[model samples]
Target: MVCAVIINAENKRIKLCNEIIGLMYGYIQWNSYDTEAGGIILGRENLGNDNLIFEFITKPMKKDIRTKNRFLRKDSEHIEFYKQLYSKHNGVYAYYGEWHTHPEDIPHYSIIDLTNWRKISKEDPKEMQYHIIVGRKQLRIWEMRKKCFMPKLVCEVKWDEINI
Candidate 1:
């Protein structure tokens, strides 16, 4: 099966594993990006919703972040519709960040994801500066250098168990 992966360019390993794991464990669905433009998107099926908990990003999300419908790229309306869908669902069943997919509830990101996140993290890797993963069991953070990547263990979270 063909699958996509976002990675950290420096270490070429998975980035933001914890968030990914949480998303997967909860259910199957898409989420949103913490950008200024404000839009929600949908990914492959079997996903329900995701919640992100990050503090800051050095580079805040652009007010004009781009959007594309995986199935209806030709029609911009579809994109707009989903964004509204996300917005309407927000605060209840919706989200506020980018949407991604994984092969299973494995909870890992690809090299591309890491690379992208590294750039985002560079702007701000401060506490609460989290990136969401669409699939997997647990969140995995990768520390990399010079565009090479490797897996770094991060704190594991339980979606089912409520924290005190």
Candidate 2:
């Protein structure tokens, strides 16, 4: 059964996101919640088939407040930063959702994770958002549907495809 949102990304983008997430794990371990990185997932959406092709990603703003294993908070400044980036790109990119890292070798979503995704879905009922949790060696994806998050498959990736 499908348990996470299907993510279709280029190999380089996936590699980059994974690398950044891995760095977060190291930072959390070395410095304790002082650093975390995340940003919008940019891609094409085939609404008719419920498929998404994520082509690019953004970096989280420096102002975000991250915890040991959670993206605890994001201030308005960070939101504005994303908005500006999206706007400047001439609508090519959108607020697809979020991606963050965890410290565990196999991390699972927490209550806070569900709550945040639910909140975003509720606030933006018309659009479907996604959330990705990158663990040391595991990647989990969730799609917001009808005010909730659902797991889906990682359908495809680019060159030298690495099936997570």
Give the winner by lDDT: 2
**Residue range 1-164, candidate 1, lDDT tens digits:** 11223343332222223333333334332244311111122322113423222311112123333332111123345345556655665523222233343444445666666666566445433322234443334333333333333434333333333221
Q: Encode model 2's per-residue lDDT on 1-164: one tens digit a residue.
A: 11223344433222234443333334333334444455656555444554455545555556676656556545566466557766886664456777776665555667877777778788874556667665555556666665445534332222113423
lDDT scores in order: 0.34, 0.54
For model 1, what is the error of residue 33's alpha carbon versus the real structure, in angstroms, after optimal superposition? Answer: 22
Name the lDDT of candidate 2: 0.54
TM-score of each candidate? 0.31, 0.62
Error of 2 at 114 (Å): 0.7
Q: Candidate 1: where is the Cα deviation over 4 Å?
A: 1-101, 125-128, 134-151, 158-164
